[model samples]
Target chain A: MAEPTPSLAPARPPTGPRVWNNPRARAIIYQVLVLGGVIGAAAYLIDNTLTNLAERSIRSGFSFIWHEAGFAISEALIDYQPNHSYVRAFIAGLLNTLKVGLLGIVLVTILGIIIGIARLSTNWLVARLASVYVETFRNVPLLLQLYLWYSLLTEMLPGGRDALSLFTAFYLNKSGLMYPVPVYDGIHPFMIVAFLIGCVGAYAWGRYATRRHEATGVPTPRFWPSVGFVLGLPLVVWLIGGAPTAIDVPQMERFRFVGGWHVSIEFIALLLGLVVYTGAFVAETVRAGILSVSRGQTEAALSLGLRRGLVLRLVLLPQALRVIMPPLTSQYLNLMKNSSLAVAIGYPDLVAVANTTLNQTGQAIEAIAVIMAVYLTISLAISGFMNWYNKRVALVER
Target chain B: MINLAERRAASGPVIQMAGVNKWYGEFHVLKNINLEVRSGERVVVCGPSGSGKSTMIRCINRLEEHQKGRIVVDGIELIADLKQIDAVRREIGMVFQHFNLFPHMTVLENLTLAPMWVRNTPRKEAEDAAMAYLERVKIPEQAHKFPGQLSGGQQQRVAIARSLCMKPKIMLFDEPTSALDPEMIKEVLDVMIELAQGGMTMICVTHEMGFARTVADSMVFMDGGEIVEKAPPTEFFKNPKSERTKLFLSQILH
Candidate 1:
């Protein structure tokens, strides 16, 4: 109702950080001050770094990226030689970290879901067990949990030829696990291509099925389509001898895993610890999300004759996910940051590698920059995904 | 509020209760309650807070369990058998005072929920049924809007719409308009009146005596978990029987 107000009138304080008098001007000044502080600090540090570098008889630049990395990795997913450049070594480490991160995210999410649903179950034993798990894990220090998991594995795992062998294919030993690797020998660049195509088709088919079910009560045979893409595509390639590539399943041998790649105990310990500790936190968030859904919603669903299972899957989960996802994203970001604790286990994550490079090369400024850039990229990706999911499931009822 | 009924209808009762008792541990909430409601009847229950007016209707839906006596709704006995209770619940719809509309759904979705999910009606059929009910409530235009976006009255009406979507034979409203703004209260009352006129059996827990007088065939007054009086709207308003009912009527009317 209050219109025709003059813009030159005294600025409301909520207009955000302002100039001494002008709100916009005040915001500008505040921003510039922050920028100036950061730049000034960076400049001073850079000057100090350059002076130190000159005095220490060293240079700072990407020239080091090309120098041979003589250090050997205990486990490498790709072809690697000590003769490779430092950049190649860093790439190998980065890929390894991604591999661990991806697996950890998947396992923790599954574990979190199971525990959360268990917490709300009507069965007395199940509920009590879930509650106990949540209370125990949530209260313990995560770093301590990591150390416990490390020791538990080291002490329990079999040693040498006495190692636990599952399916006669995978070996669990004191050092770590050795499993058959699927190694492709030739131009089956088409495996990656077919796999990507199969994934896209599976996603599309699922969406189409959902749409079809919503439009018509006719249920589509969606499971077969997904199974076909996931299982059949790989089979087709294998049957055709992969047209260009052939795979081999490695076996254990004396003093070595002769046929497949070996996963170091350090990597397993880091991933296992990270997943369990973070999964417990994620479980709490999931439980809270489920709790936030009012009892009235469930009652209403029940009144409508919706069965328990459908009510949970169709009605409750969509709404609960909206509440769960925001906190869940924070847990994921925390897990990624906490993964930096890999230094404790001698795993070379981005931060760990950067920390070592800083100490060895005396290029502290560059090392810190690399750490910041890598983390910032990771944080941004997680944040973007969370925002997208938030938009997708936000309560339309509101 | 509108009062036209002068006497309780003379008929066999559709709902019968005897020696009904309920307690929340040591608190004897509903005690020795006895009542009857007939088919095609509209009854208004009124009392002070903690009088258990809401609990009585909830017991009909098995939303709250009574520890003693028995309640028979449309010939189905309310008992320990959960399946029977659910079957009876599907036949009766209850609207809440808080307008507990699902905040994650649109008004249309709210109205269609019970029909499609419970009744196993197809989406299109449920949507059509919902539209009919929404039209009855005079908020069909707002079908796509989320419940939170609506005013209290609108939300209550949508809740009523949601209950009606099940095509329930009986309706129980727990203070349907209590939370609405005064101006919006009439819109909901009007819809209730239309439903009554159409012979959809209703038991409303409300303080709107004016509404009770107009739409209700009889008014049941409760106090300390017992029915104090049951009379037609005209006699109930003009000359309430019991001393407690008179006192309550005085305070509420004033």
Candidate 2:
């Protein structure tokens, strides 16, 4: 009675070219009309701009990229002398744009994960704190948050020589926070190479260890190996004349602090605005994903004699991630694109740099074209990576 | 319904219930019920819908948690604490009418999952035990395929095999053939009949009178959440003791 005569024969998979000549030809027609409209509008705008410039006896071209950028950037990635060409200034501003974008993404992901888990906590206080964090940040506009953070930070920091001091020479001020910058010679580059090698080696070993644990139920040794490479290699490099080459503590003693790495108020404002606002939305998405998994699944995992942490890590999270990831990827993409709001704070991201370049050169077409291409490329790359990851974790059988 | 187990009789008692009562917000489902089943005994429970027959069976494993009752299966009593209920559930295998097999897992994995996870059985040993059970249920070849690929009859057989892999002292059938098509029902019954002949203790809730006649040593009739009558199958059918039981018998038997 108990014997199960299961079918070994796999059903033939469905096959076909399932699109394009289909009944949804209206979609194609609609897309064509939209494309036509965009092209028509762009041409009209371009014609109007050139006609106006000619009437005003102004030349329309990119000869301005070679002209000096007279304005001083409040904060810049590469050293930008006022004597540098506008094109060079644009490049520096573009790098700063990415710096804020990258830093914001990292902070939001880490904070989002922590807050998301906290929202699911059984402890009343932990869940409440997470709820408060999400609600407070999400209800406010991102631009307002940027203004608030920038203003509050500047107001708290000391002006001139009264900069707030930490441990030794690090100084916090209205202009920027000044942290130690390593002063070094040629050997410093080798130490950096060693540090990079150590990081890569440690990560590769960690991945290998994870695979071994999964395959054989034995955790591969990781701590000693990681420490030896990440810490020991750098130490050895330092002993070989890299120590003085790599080490330089920041020193501050006067009205204008000197000898340190500085972060501009604009950069801080932009990064803070993006992270707190985006992180709030991310928290809600994660909470929804966790709640979507049925309570019965948790009970079943417990009944299977799995430990509490193992139940969450293996049984609950695997299912929750399947539900969470598609939407989470979209949020991350939204955050990256939304960083263009850096212009509102006078932070010269691609948009701001391109705007100034267009004003000086009267080359509206070229400047806007560059802006569109850069944003489009960034958006497409994010989408492609997300799609790949989605396929990896998605449920195989419905 | 009532039965005394310790007469030191021919077959040993595998399950016993006494003074069982269940109420859900003022509606009593099972009322003052008592029963015991000897080893290898096959008891058929017949009742109209909403008769608490399911509730009574569910109480044996503390699934429904009877409001006031004492149910001891394979010697472990269902108590307020969960450990007692979990312990009782391990020894009492159950097959639902819906089959309730894990659809995501392969047939063999479904059979092995509980043993490997709950019983702490090694993977190899669990798979071996699962394979043996799959063979007993006549579905070893389908072990690698998901439950979705199997026909209704095959899934039921897999469900039966999954329970057997637990090696319970007794098996409970909660209308196992009710959800099957006419042709498929016969296959599941044939498997159950085979189990009954092999001396497995069983309590089946069913509308299949032919099966009841063939396998049930005794029969119990429940109505309106109460057991109204019970007797040995031959006597119970030919000369039932209650007017309500006679009416239930005629409606189902005819």
State which candidate has the highest DockQ: 1
Poorest lDDT segment (10 consecutive residues) of candidate 2 chain A: A298-307
Q: Please give the distance, in angstroms, between residue B2's alpha carbon in candidate 2 and its true position after superposition.
A: 24
Instruction: Give each model a TM-score.
Output: 0.83, 0.69
Local error of candidate 2 at residue A309 (angstroms): 3.9
- TM-score: which candidate is best? 1
Best by lDDT: 1
Q: What would you estimate as the lDDT of candidate 2?
A: 0.79
lDDT of 2 by residue, B30-64 (tens): 99998988877889999898999988987876657
Tens digits of per-residue lDDT for model 2 on A296-371?
4554444333445655765567667777888888887888888888888787788888887777676777788777
Once fitted onto the true fold, the runs of candidate 1 whose alpha carbons sit more than 4 angstroms away are: A1-37, A120-132, A165-171, A179-261, A355-360, B1-28, B32-35, B65-86, B120-125, B226-231, B234-247
Docking class of 1: acceptable
Per-residue alpha-carbon lDDT of model 1 for A1-398, expressed as tens digits? Answer: 87896679776678564348887878889999999999999999989978988998787776777777776665667777878876777677677777777788888899998998898899999999988988887788878877887888889887877778888888888888878766765435666666778888899999997667556645456878998996677667656763543345456668666676678888899998888888888988998999988887776676665667767966788889989988998888888778878777777776666665666676677777777787788878988988898889876655
Record all residue pairs in model 1 with backbone atoms less than 3 Å apart, i.e. clashing. Answer: A18-A26, A19-A26, A250-A259, A304-B118, B1-B210, B1-B211, B2-B214, B3-B213, B3-B214
Give the whole-model CA lDDT for all candidates, comma-separated: 0.82, 0.79
Q: For model 1, what is the C-alpha lDDT against the true structure?
A: 0.82
